[model samples]
Target: MKNSIAFSRRSLLALTAGVLLTGCEQNTFVPPPPRVVEVAHPVQKTFTRYLETTGNLAPINTVDLVARVQGFLQSINYKDGAFVKQGASLFTIEPQTYELQLEQARAAEAGGQATLKQAQLDFQRQATLVQKDDVAQSTLDVSTATRDNAQASRRQAELNAKIAEINYGYTNVAAPFDGIVSNHLVSVGELVGVGSPTQLATIVALDPIYVNFNVNEQDVLRIRDVMRRRGMTADDLNQVPVEVGLQTDIGYPHKGKLDYVSPSLNQSTGTLAARGVFSNPDHALLPGFYVRVRVPFDKQDALLVPDVALGSDQAGRYVLVVNNDNLVEQRKVAAGPREGDLRVIESGLSPDDRVITAGLLRAIPGQKVDPQLRKIDVSE
Candidate 1:
């Protein structure tokens, strides 16, 4: 009985030890699973750098027509809003009074010519009498003076006739250019050109429209720097090509050339005024309409990454990159304008670097990750 009791105690101690070891094993800690992240290599391509801005459409030429002479407006020769050719009659002032004045001027001119002819005849007779010593020298001198005064009067009368003719021509108002004319400001038979030059109509050229825009000083300086690197002169700025789109249009569809750049920045707005000329043959672009302008200045090979890979902090913009060993690394990046779904990686990333595009929250910097390689649509 003593031997059997000793054997049972040993078995109980072994069972107790086994139970304690099992409890310790159950309490031991196990680490969580590794994070999963979608990764992609940065895309390299020849990217075109475009400066986009907004502007307003303007006419190449706009003029407000005004009467040049005083008269009652006889008639409006043009239909309202009609396209007219250069020198087409637009309005008519009363020509009867001008014509009558012209007739009186001609009659005065005729009388002057008759008086001049009589004076010439008298001077010729006096010269003959003086040569023959049949007339007094003082009398011959008086005849010469009278003839000279009559000649002066005849010339003055001729000038007065020309003035009358010009006044008569001014009665008919004509268009200064080929353009669309606005509605007549003065109705027929209304007194026009009274006291002040009366507003008659307005004209605007349709084809080859102008687009006006303003660029900030910073952008202007950047563009100048770019031109300097290319050895371009100030004259070459007008050669830069520009593209424009209307508010309803999707992309820049109308192509144009930059023909104007301000010599100095505006002090009030800190912007430089610029203009582009577009051949708007269809008259699709009208003055005062809003438009989008894009100026392409340079092209270069650049690294592009998915926009989802970017993150922002107090340090500005940053992106997560996976190293060759599949370790997550946070890199601060210099990002540029967005190109579709991708953002331009201006400085920070290399073409071969793998960027974490998804599951970024699951991945921690300095930690290992199961990076699932994926392709980014650079075209997007």
Candidate 2:
């Protein structure tokens, strides 16, 4: 009985010790492994520096089509809003009346020519008679005066004929250039140009369009400085390449060249007016369209990171990075223009810093992370 009790007590002690050891093991904490994150150094690239601004697309030419002759509208020769070539007839006034007037002036010119010829013959005959002493000098003088008057009348008639022809030509309204014409402002049979020049329509040239924009004074100074450094003249400045894009475009797809730059800045606006000329063969661009403009001035190496990796908060734009200690950190960055899916880091970022490109949600600032170093595919 003593041996049985001793054995039972020893077993009980062992069981209690085992239970306490198990409790201790359960109470002890084991932290989870650091969250896995993908990190990469910023991609270095040679990117062209650009001056970006917003602008409006304008036609290179806009002219008001008007009637220069007094007449009733005869016929409309072109469809409303149709694109017409230079000198293509668009409207016809009462051409018959102008044509008749031109013919009348020509007839008067012919009569004057006949009269001048007769007077010249008479003057020559009288001069011959006087030289032969067959007629008096007075007769020769009268013939000479008659000849001069006839000559003057002939010149007057010729000028009148020319004027009449011009009026006749004005009876037909034609496009002054290749452009799209606005709708006709007058109906057929409407009397136009009776008192003053009447506006019939407007024509706008579209191809090789103009883009008007303004550069802030600061940008103007910057551009001028760059030009000076490059030893570029004012004409060379016009050769700089410009790019444009519509609001819906992904980037600047339309290409052009700097056509004009204002010599002075506007005091009220504090901007320098600028313009670019682009070949718009398809006429996809129109007048008064808001567009984005960019002028490339310089090219240099820059650091870029995935745009998705950027974040924003009260501290402005920021990104997550991993330090040499494999700890996550938040870095404030001055963001620049976007290149593809990446963004240029203008300031506040080091080339060697490992930016967190993926697994951002799991990467908490001030916490250790298992950084998986990877190469950024810039092409992607």
Candidate 3:
């Protein structure tokens, strides 16, 4: 009877221990939520959003040097890659052949002039002869006709000589404008004539360089709307202009004017070409360089947030905004132009709203969280 009583007591003790141990295991297995940081948004206006693109640089003027008259290249007048002034001689062809032609034409013209003078005198004599009856009517008529024929021949010869003079000048290849010339295609003694299809060299005007880029036709309509919104007159675009950017640097070095926008959209590209002219007296902007361009529209004030402070959901875009009670409120936002890494909010956010960025995954709508404020790393 004593043994039975002891066994019942042991069983009861084991049951109590098992129940206490089960409760402790459940408590130890539960995980606490993660901590998150956020920042308060201050309402302010910022003016610097840029339209980016890759553009190519080019000279304002490009010319191909061609020989007007057929002749053997006698000499290269200018050094290869030399800067030439307008009307500077670049090459010289064999002038001997053209010179001979000119001389022969001049001699023919002189002989014709002498013949014309004699004809004038003979016509006068013939008129006098018919009136004084010193010669027959038929004889006077014959002399007059001969004088007229000689006069016509002299005029033709004078025209031929003038043409010859022009051909002689063509033997010297003169620069068309002030520019840098390319390397010589033919040596001094090489043959350069009508048979040669390409130009002997090329010249490009580098000063006051131009940058060319393309923009979508849809953007064209928007630009025009901006111009009208600014109360711009027809002449205003000539005075006020758009600025450009370069990939060589992070931002545009200097401002430029919108010089050209294509009248019609390119059919193949479905875009229009735009050109901006900038003074490149320092030659800092070289020709044929690919660059990025930025143009500002107008200043506007809007709610904005750093890219890090936002999250993408199946329901478009939303952010975990913190309320005064530190509760996470999922607010849907309309995004606008991205200025650097920040997004301009078009709607759905107010001033001084704290947004959770770093620990976004740890947040849920209506969940309470510990709000820690932090700044973005500025080194990037």
Candidate 4:
């Protein structure tokens, strides 16, 4: 019985020792987290000097065709959406009424002319009679007055005929300028009246189109500096080079020039209105199309860091950078204007330093990490 008790104690002690050792081994086996490092190699990229703004494309010219006279729509000469030229026939009002009015006026004018011719003969005869004392002065005077009355009547008739002719010309509705027409609003034989109150259609000029954009006050200052550096005056702005861009289904494809800059800034919006002109021989740029503007400026090289590596703290903005010893560090950085995916590093970092790009959520300041150093291409 004594030997059995001793053996049981030994077995319990051995099991207790094994448990303690296992706990110790586990305590030493803590896993390390992944680390990301920023690369410092010079990269080649076209840092486009650009300004982002919302803008809309507009036709160089837009006009609404409205009725000017009372008449039935005799014909719609131009099809809806058809390209039209200046003075092109668009609508024909029933001109039969106007034509008849014109004929009546012409007849009256002819009658007045005949009367004037007879009065002139009578005046000549009266003048001869008065000069030769062949007739009484009072009779000659009466004849002269009659001749003047006839002349006045002839002038009135001529003025009436011209008014009728103008009304008759209004029957043929012609385009004021070259442009594409919109849908027809009225059908043939519809009672369209003077001041064809309803628009026949809308026409927009597409070639050398205008792209309207607004410039912020700050950008205006920058542009002014640029202009001064180029020795440009107000008169020079009309000829200044302007570049325009638009994003299409196939990507940003269309190109144009900056042709117009508004003389005054929009007070309500606090922006300067500007325009860009582009060729639309194919009529691709329709008025009211949405597009982006790309305004290029002088190229500059600046210190930058990827946006992913940056973080905000109570002390402002900072980055987790892996210093020379490959250890995690908290760097308080001053950031400046953003350049695409990277931001200009105003201070607290150098071109030779590497900043941590990822693994930030898993990291804390002063923590030791198993660094998976991936080289970042800062040039992109």
lDDT of 2 at 77: 92
Off by over 4 Å in 3: 1-38, 46-51, 124-151, 194-198, 231-242, 313-320, 340-342, 352-380
Model 4 residue 165 lDDT score: 96
Candidate maximizing lDDT: 2
Question: Clashing residue pairs in candidate 3, if any?
Answer: 247-292
Better of 3 and 4 by lDDT: 3
Ranking of predictions according to TM-score? 2, 1, 3, 4
TM-score of each: 0.79, 0.90, 0.74, 0.68
Cα misplacement distance, residue 311 of candidate 4 (Å): 8.0
What C-alpha lDDT do the candidate models reach, one value each? 0.91, 0.94, 0.78, 0.77
lDDT tens per residue, model 2, 1-380: 99999999999999999999999999998999999999999998898889999999999999998999988899999988888999999999998988999999999999999999999999999999999999999999999999999999999999999999999999988998999999999999999998899999999999889999999999888888888988899989778988999999978999999999989999999999999999998998999999999999988899999999999999799999999899999999999998889999999888899999999999999999999999998874
Could you give candidate 1's per-residue lDDT for residues 271-341 as a string of tens digits?
99999999987889999999999999888888999888899999999999899888899999999987888
TM-score of 1: 0.79
Cα lDDT for residue 186, model 4? Answer: 86
Which residue ranges in model 2 land beyond 4 Å of their true spot? 1-14, 25-27, 121-144
For candidate 3, lDDT tens digit of each residue in 1-380?
Answer: 99999999999999999999998988886556635655556335654544556688889999888877887888888888888899998988889999999999999999999998998898899899899999899987888888888889898899999999998998888888888899988777776676655378999888888888888877777767877887875456555455555565765665777778677899999888878888877667779988777666556667667776777788878777889988889899987777667777878888778877667777778888888876543222
Query: Each candidate's root-mean-square deviation in Å?
Result: 4.4, 2.6, 5.8, 6.4
Supply candidate 1's per-residue lDDT for 303. 90
